[model samples]
Target chain A: MKIVIVEYGMGNIRSIVSTLQYLGVQDVVLSSDFEILNSADKIILPGVGSFGKAITQIRHRNIDNYLNEIVLENKKPILGICLGMQLLGNSSTEDGNNKGLGYINGYVVKFDNSLVKVPHVGFNQVKVNNKLKLYNGFNDIPTDFYFTHSFRMKSDVEINQCYCNYQEDFVASFERDNIAGVQFHPELSQTNGLKLLKNFIDKF
Target chain B: MLRKRIIFSLIYSDGYFMQSRNFRLQKVGNLNWLEKNYRFQSIAFALDELIVLNASKTEKNITEFAKTVSDLVNDVFIPIAAGGGIRTLEDAELLFNSGADKIVLNSLLFQDPNMVMKIIENYGSQSVVASVDCKLNLGSYEIFINNGTKKLDYDIQKYLIYLEELGVGEIYLNSIDRDGTGFGYDFDLIKIVEDITKLPLIIAGGAGNENHLAKGLQINKVSAVATANLFNFIGNSIPNARDYLLDNGLNLSNRVFDTLDLI
Candidate 1:
């Protein structure tokens, strides 16, 4: 199966490709082109950096439109990682009230600096949503995944959401049918991350 | 629960990984030798993060260093922070493109605050890690830049406050005195600097054994503990250290992935 990592000039695309290759994935392409995205068996929207800048770049490349066609219209499975996951939400408070892609029913907000340290870095325990295809192997146990971000997504909707706690519980990952998003970097989360990616590839 | 991290740092000079002692570097081995001796890929599973610093004192060529970074992080599924000679935005971008999840800055944080700001602006503060090398001289901590060669006038407290104000995601505090000594981390220094900033603090240098690591982690303020001493923790040493940490009931990740054949 061919998997395309949607690259709109953001994130560590090399690691994603290398991890997929390590998992014995034959065809893993990193491209933002519409045709390339459309031709994939699965698509990964990997992102890092600011939400405002990412949204601006996505709009500039008409990637939002392309994703609307490829993912929304075609019902193709898509997994968004870190900032990529936040962009799938409705809006964000980061960089002065930025709007997201509006795919998932959630909004992003920065962690209260008064409470916990900002930019929650390092490995954190994620309560895996075992009901979904994103986490297929583990039996409802909290797994460790690498997370690095200031802003986090919070949703009131039932999206098969998995929660992780820094100070309070927040969305770690969510899976709804073919659409999935994780606040952590599966590509960077060691063996646990590799397992999650494999689940996305094989099950989704 | 957010677990404390066990980070393994690789000190690279020219094309070889070095064993550093009190800011002086001794050439240990090249990439092949590292893989053959340590088998870093397998050992990386026990690590939360990997930091590769290019300490090429002669000429810090970012392109060549980035290639080495790329080679090291091929299948290692952990957050890799690479730096040393990242002067411009293009240099930071090159390292990120080469598979660095985060970029470490040392001299640039002091030399050019504007360049540091630019990198922070583009990649966000979380993508940038401020590495401060400190040495306790005459009972006062002095900060160092330029690969620990030049000492700054301001003390570590002032420098740390400055870094926090500058909006860096994390602080990699390496004690030059304890570096590669196999003695232990400077807990007194950590006590002084722990309350200065709200950013995640990664304490580096020293740490010869699992007990040292455990002691470092026992301190509530430390976010991560790093050890760069190659000889101390070689072969199955890291994996063994991790198991020891876990068995001792330390708050580290213990998720077993025996289903590698699931895919």
Candidate 2:
């Protein structure tokens, strides 16, 4: 399937492109153009920065409403990673108050320090919701995955697929029909990460 | 279902694998080797802290390097803690924006105590990590900076108190003399730092095997053990560390490797 990765000048773009290429996905394009983004068969929004910076870029581009309409109305499969996943939420309190794509019903907040270290750096385990099709070929439940973020999604939304505990329970992966988002970077997740991308290419 | 914590060491300097006592910088394995073979269940890694040496030399370039490192790290799923040349609030911002989950600062904390306050003001205390490279000088331990090339006269215990007062999220204590020796960790030094601070402590330097990791974890004051040569040379992976820790009865988080099936 032809995939389009949203480029908004925040963080790593080449790595995601390389990952897609590694998964045998030849039809991948990184574009900031609205028409190109809206016309893609599959959309992947990958981010490595803060929630506020991402929301700001999306808003400045004036693609917030368009993204919401495309995902919620058209049902095109879109995957959001790291800050991209946080952007799928309603709002975030990173540097300041910022509004997200509002595709999911929740807000992003800084991690509570009482439970785990902030940024929740390094590798941690993830438990899948089992009902989602994105995790098709993995057998080791609670597998280790790389993570690097302070703000996480706190949603009362309909697409909560997986949750991980850092300080407290937070959304790790979520899916609402064709719209799926993972808080972790599937591209950075080594063999398991590649497996995830392969599943996305195969199933979606 | 025990969760594992992984440790990583970032070799900032240009160097190569050594045999016996001779050390030289040679082109070694590809980065893919780290991606493919060196598997740890959960790992903690390091950042090149080169701020105190000659700030003017690496100051402007390190921020961009952080971005490059972030992109490189995105291909691997293990947890990485980036240190080196972190000085101001802007440096921390650039690092985090570049995809660093944790920032390890040593020179900045000693040079200007307010730097921590500024970080806490912006990113909260939990995101700021105080990295202490300590060495025994005479009868007391002193803090060393600039990649363990310079020694500070300040007492390690006093600095630990000051770090606690500054409200840092975590502390990474590395023994400079023991680093890369593969002999084992300096448990006494770790005990001293742990006795002074309640924050989560990550111990680095001189981890040779699973037994060293198990011994380090037994300290109770240490939250995690970090190694560079051990995982690189000793052939121990993160999964092996986790299995050892789990078999020992430590309650770690549950990892689900089968989630790939959902795709």
Candidate 3:
């Protein structure tokens, strides 16, 4: 399958590409070109920085416009990881109030450092809603995934969601039609992560 | 629940990966030797995270070290944090672009606090790990930087507080005296400063076996246990240690998936 990782100069694109290649994807492309992005069988949005800065880069590079056409209108499958997943939400409080793609009805807020540590680094168990296409073959269990972020997403829409408790339970992964996102780094989470990525490639 | 981590750190100096003891380097093998013996594709399953540090001494070449990092991370499917001689933003960019999920900073924490702040500002705090090398001196933990050669004026506890103020995501506290000794982690040093900061602590230096790792993880403040003892954990040692940790309930990632089945 032709996989395109949308790159706007903000995240760990190399590891994402390496993971894709390891998964036997022969035609994985890291490009934000209008035609290339629209024509891909699957698209991954990987990121690892400030959400405000990332959205600015995306808008400046006109990627926000391209994603609207390809992801919103055309209905192509797109999986957003970490900051990429945060960008698919309505808004985020990272750095300052900034707009997201608004594909999912959610908003991002920082974890209370008083309750739990900031950045929330290391491996954490994700309570998987197995009914979602992203967790297709996985059993109904809270599997582990790597998470390292300060801000988290919450939505009242009740989409197929996965939850992880750090300071308290927060959004881990969510799916809405063609749009899916994980607050964890599937590329770095080892086996469980690789399995989740495989499910994205096969089921989503 | 947020689980503890088992981090396997690789020390690369010049052209070969080195065996580090008391901050002294000894050439062990090259990338080929590592691939043949460790086989990251297989052994990677045994680690929660991998830290690759560029410990070159004579006029460090950042580009060559980053190339090694990229090549090393190809088959390794875990969070890789690479550093050592990360002086500027360009150097960090090269490492991150070459497949490093986080940048480990040592000397910069002392010499260039601004640089650390800049990296955290640009990449966010989650992408920066502050590596503080400490040595026990007369019942006091003295902090050392610049590849563990130069001793800093700041005390280890005070330096940790400074690092926390800089907004680093985690602290990789390595004991220089216990390094490569295979005795165990400096429990006294860790006990003194373990509660100084709230950031996730990764205890490194003298983990010789699974029991040593378990002892490090048993400390509630220590978020992970890191080891670079090549002599101890080379072949089946990693998988074996992982089994020991699991059987004893170390809170490591217990999820099992066929490495080949992902494809």
What's the best-to-worst order under lDDT?
A: 1, 3, 2
Native contacts kept, each candidate: 0.82, 0.19, 0.87
Candidate 1 lDDT over B1-263, as tens digits, reads 78899999999988999999998999999999998988878888889999999998987888989999999779488889999999999999999989898999999999899999999999988899999999998898999999889989987778898888888889999999999999999998898889787889999989999999999888888999999999999989999999999999888886558535644
Docking class of 1: medium
| Cα lDDT of model 3 by residue, B1-263, tens digit | 99999998999998899999998999999989988978766887888999998898888899999999898778787899999999999999999999899999999888898988999998889899999898988878888888878888987667888889989999998999999888999999888778698899999999898899999989999999999999899889988998998898888877657776777
DockQ of 1: 0.76
Task: Give lDDT tens digits, candidate 2, residues B122-172.
Answer: 655656778888887786787877756677777877788888889787788
DockQ-based CAPRI category assigned to the predicted complex of candidate 3: high
Candidate 1 vs candidate 3: which has greater DockQ?
3
Q: Score the docking of each candidate (DockQ).
A: 0.76, 0.18, 0.85
Q: What is the lDDT of residue B108 in candidate 3?
A: 87
Q: Which should have the higher lDDT, number 2 or number 3?
A: 3
Q: Write the per-residue lDDT of candidate 1 for residues A85-169, one digit (tens) a residue.
A: 9999999998889989999999999899999988898789988767679888776888889899999999999888999999999
